[model samples]
Target: MGDPHPKIEARAVTRVFGRAARAVHALGPVDLTVAPGEFTCVVGPSGCGKSTLLRIAAGLLRPSSGELRIRTNARRPAAMIFQDYGIHDWKTVLANIRFGLDVQKVPRREADARAAHWLDRMGLTDFAAAYPAALSGGMRQRVAIARALAVEPEILLMDEPFAALDAQLRTILQDELLGLTQTTRTTTLFITHSLEEAIVLGDRVLVMSARPGRVIAERRPPFPRPRTGAVRATPEFAALTSELWELLRGEVGAGAAA
Candidate 1:
């Protein structure tokens, strides 16, 4: 049979900030496709427009050229998690998780049930009434993640959601995320600077050049599916991480100079 249609497709996508001589060419002429149930990660230098590419996919920013297409029948087609933990302080943990459902006008009872389910799954059940200020950075991030997952989005765009956490906590959440996404088979696009993270979490890892970023290399982890943190212990994982770093090392210097 023919290949199934892409869940997310971008063709010659580009983004520019400002205009005239002040124009900052932030991203693309990039082309990429994410198939249904795929987890893709992007790794690049600091100024490489990694986040710009994600924001464009999220429909939060308009690209200067090219096109982005998302094909999914999900009531909420996409949900995004940011590094800063996008949960609202004004909303309690339960309410924060239910926010999207509320916006979609889901029945109040159903929304509450769904939110509560995710709260328990994320280990936030006891903190249902707590505000963002009352939680630690890790817990607040969990609330943000629970809120996104409660909506059951077809596409999950995560921009270094675990980047700020301590190493132990980051691994804990990474393993949790691996299990969740594998079970749901959600199409995910994760952007991170950590090569090990990209390898551990992504089926396919794409490397980008500096500044005006473009895909420089694409590598798929040879590891099997339903992966956990143990995959990082294998020799292949180390080699692949080293390979990606070499591809990115020069770009890092270039981005710094730019």
Candidate 2:
């Protein structure tokens, strides 16, 4: 019964920065959607406005024109996890996770309980008392995820959350993220530069054009859920990745030339 629904919709959304003669068209009128319980990844070269698009969806940045709508059954708004993890270095992991709930005016005891639950779920229970500085990159990211989930938001928007981690750590986090998504069934929109990562995590991959970014193509992986490391080796996976790479290579080259 957990059928996909339109949890987030972006229709003809355009974003421009600066004034008069210096104006920069960061994003074109892009149309996109994130379905309920689906993980959609947006991949493109640098300056493709992937992060800008996500910020707009999270309501951090207003679009110069067009519309972005987030709909969910929950009263809370969507939560965002940034590439830097965005944790308070001075605060304990538990404190950081509880921060959102506190802002929402949830009771202290209730917030602490919810934070504890997610910390345990994300395997951060042992580091509850530790500060961001004391944890490794992966642990910091887990705390970020726990913090976002603590609020019980209907949607999760991630802007290359694993881009800074090492290869090994990134792989581990990818699997962990998938597990979390499966268990909670949260609607997610993830942005990444790694095509392999996009294929691994995304139900649908949206490839964007360079500069004045727009959705160039949308590819749905043929594989089923509960995807594991083995799926990447299959012929179907290879073909899909190759096709995306072919399309992306030209955009990346064009961006470089500009």
Candidate 3:
């Protein structure tokens, strides 16, 4: 079948919010595509509509104009992992991971088995019976990821999932995520403000302009997976980060000024 098509595609998608007096142009005529088994990261200054773009791709919000398409054989469109680890406080780790499967009417036993498999793989088996409140920030985010993978969707949409963790924990989780992606090969669209993260994790990085965001640059990383601490110190990695910073610094300053 001619190698199939992109797992998700966005064609001139735009999103605007609020009424005339308070109307905000969050995004404008953005075009992007995420291929199967590829990892793409979107980065930009604050309030540049990075999150808005990701939400549109996930079908969580409809674009005000243009088209967002997700092609998948699975009934569930895409699974999202939020920055805040959006797990239910009342639900135990295992239960939270199984929620999507439960909603889709997968057999309870099968769902439990799948949850256990991911929990062990994610190193969260011991915490399965614990509630969200009991887990550390990193552990909670792991649960969020496991929950998304439970649904076995065609794409994973992540919105700064590691931003809230401490620097050390964030780095640790970043490496863990790289390993997870390698094993699962899930098409992913990850959003982040960290240039280091974008360089380290993404196969390609898309840089956006200031508010009313539009793609300003696209960079392909030269490193191979699984990306490690060593890659970050390489000349190629440093050069990519410097280039991305040059593109983003002005937008960041402008956003802050406004």
Candidate rank order under lDDT:
1, 2, 3
Candidates in order have lDDT scores of 0.93, 0.91, 0.90
Q: Report the error of model 1 at residue 140, Å.
A: 0.7
Q: Any idea how many clashes model 2 has?
A: 0
**RMSD list, candidates in order:** 1.2, 1.5, 1.4
Give the C-alpha miss distance for residue 25 in model 3, angstroms.
1.0
Which candidate leads the pack in lDDT? 1
Model 2's alpha-carbon lDDT is: 0.91
Residue 248 lDDT in model 3? Answer: 95
**TM per model?**
0.97, 0.95, 0.96
- lDDT string for model 2 (1-258, tens) is 765558899999999999999999999789998888889999998999999999999889999999999986666778999999998898999999998998899998888789989989989889899899999999999999999989988899999999999999999899888888877888899999999999988899999999899999999988788777667789988999999999999999988986
For residues 1-258, could you state the per-residue lDDT of candidate 1 as single tens digits?
634999999999999999999999999888999999999999999989999999999999998999999998876799999999998899999989999999999899999899989999999999999999999989999999899988889999999999999999998899999999999998999999999999999999999999899999999999999788899899999999889999999999999998
Residue 158's lDDT in candidate 3: 95
Q: Write the per-residue lDDT of candidate 3 for residues 85-183, one digit (tens) a residue.
A: 989999999999999999999998899899999999889999889999988999999999999998887789999999999999999989888888878
After the best TM-score superposition of candidate 2, give how far the Cα of residue 224 lies from its true spot, in angstroms: 0.9
